[model samples]
Target chain A: MVYYISFILIGIGIYGILTQKNLFKFLVSLTIIDTAINIFIISLGYIEGKDVPIYSKYTPVANFVDPLPQALVLTAIVIGVGTLALGASLLVRVYEKYETLEVEEIAVKEARK
Target chain B: MTIATIFVGILMIISAIYAIEAKKMLDSFISLSLLSLLSVFLFVIMKAPDVAITEASVGAGLTTAVLILALRRIGGDEE
Candidate 1:
């Protein structure tokens, strides 16, 4: 159920990326895509009734949910933030150079040059 | 748990759609942030506290701030 939703989110993001004219809109779509992927990975580790993978005196490893995906997603969240920041900064430079965030305009300017 | 997951999943998809289809860039950004928050709830329902915390802080918190700052610098509208 959630898996299919993740796929739908990815499709929406892709549609936005392909159709949007603004660079910042494109970046937002990219982040949405990244988020869908993250959700899919985290969902892959879910086990019904399993306790979180916190090691404690009463917690048994047998019933603990998978810890690996959580760790991976932790790293992924930070990486996603870094990627967003980088993309935003690059958009800033593009705006400075082209004086517009619209890709069609930039392409037109390039063609005239 | 399944019901909770489904609810959050639906919320996430709805917000993602809004994020992509909204007219204003700031509105789209806010929708994206809402999407992240829904995902955080989904993470918690999935029994991944670590991921939930990370997504809340980075996705809903810092990413929105960074995007907002960028929008402020460039101005939010495409025109």
Candidate 2:
């Protein structure tokens, strides 16, 4: 079920990226895709009736969820943020130069110049 | 628990769609934040507390800030 949801989100993100003319919407779509992938990765490690990987005196150690996917997702989240920041900065730069956020307008301007 | 997880997942999809389809950039950003918040909830339900905290802080918090700042810099929703 979670997998299905994530796949649908990925589809939506791709649709947005392909159809939207605004540069900022493109970045938003990228963020959506990043988030869906992260969710899908974390869900891969989930087991029904299992506890989190955190250890405590009362909790049994054997029934904890798989920690590997969590670790990978942690790294992915950080990288997603970094990329989002970079994309946002690039959007700002593009807007500064083109005076518009529409991708088609930017292309036309570039062609004339 | 499964029911709750499914419910949140559905909400996440709805918000993701709204974020993509929203007319104004500000509305889209708000929907994006809502999607992030729902994902954090879903993370907690899936027995991934660490990822939930990280997402709540970084994904929901920092990402929204960065996008809003960029929107402001671009002079907001000219269309």
Candidate 3:
């Protein structure tokens, strides 16, 4: 289920990137798509009847739920934050220089210059 | 219950479709948030509370923040 849904999201993101003409809109769609996959990755490692991998007397190490996925998701969340900020700043710059948000218009303007 | 899972699965599918097919960027963004939340429900039913929490927080909250920030940068919608 995770694999299938994740792939569907990737396809949607690809479609957005391929078809979207608004630069910021494209970025929003892309982020949605990226998030879907990240959730999928976390879902993959889920194990029932096990405790969180936190070190404590309640949870025995032998019965710990997979900790790796949590760690990876943490990293992904940070990276996503950074990428989103950078994308937004670049988008602002793009809008300022081109004076329009349309990707085609921006490309045309750049080419003419 | 399997029936509920199947029903939730249907909702998940619908949300996924909405996320992809929405014409407005904001609509699509909202749909995406809905889908992730539904997936968290799915995770809970599948017996993964930690995943549900993470998905609800990072997947829905943080991701929504990123999308909204990106949208603000884009400004008003176009035809």
RMSD of every candidate to native, in Å, equals 1.4, 1.1, 3.2
Model 3 has a DockQ score of 0.33
Residue-level lDDT tens digits of model 2 in A1-113: 88998999999999999999988899899999989999899999999888989778768467798899999998789888898999999989988898998978888999998
Q: In model 3, state the lDDT of residue B69.
A: 73
Q: Identify the runs in model 2 with alpha carbons over 4 angstroms from their true place.
A: none
The most accurate candidate by DockQ is: 2
* A59-89 per-residue lDDT for model 3 (tens digits): 6456766778767775676677678778878
Taking all chains together, each candidate's TM-score versus the true structure is: 0.94, 0.96, 0.75
Distance (Å) between predicted and true CA of B20, model 2? 0.5
lDDT (tens digit, per residue) of candidate 3 on B1-79: 5567566666766776666666776787687778778777766654456656867787688777777776676575545
lDDT of 3 at A26: 72
| Model 2: residue A98 alpha-carbon error in angstroms | 0.6
Best by lDDT: 2
Candidate 2 lDDT at A66 equals 89
CAPRI class assigned to model 1: high
Q: Candidate 1 residues A4-103, lDDT tens each? A: 9889999999999999888888998999999999989988998878898988788845688888888988998898899889999998889889889888
- Candidate 3: which stretches are off by over 4 Å? A48-62, B1-10, B43-51
Candidate 1 global lDDT: 0.87
- Chain B TM, every candidate: 0.90, 0.93, 0.91
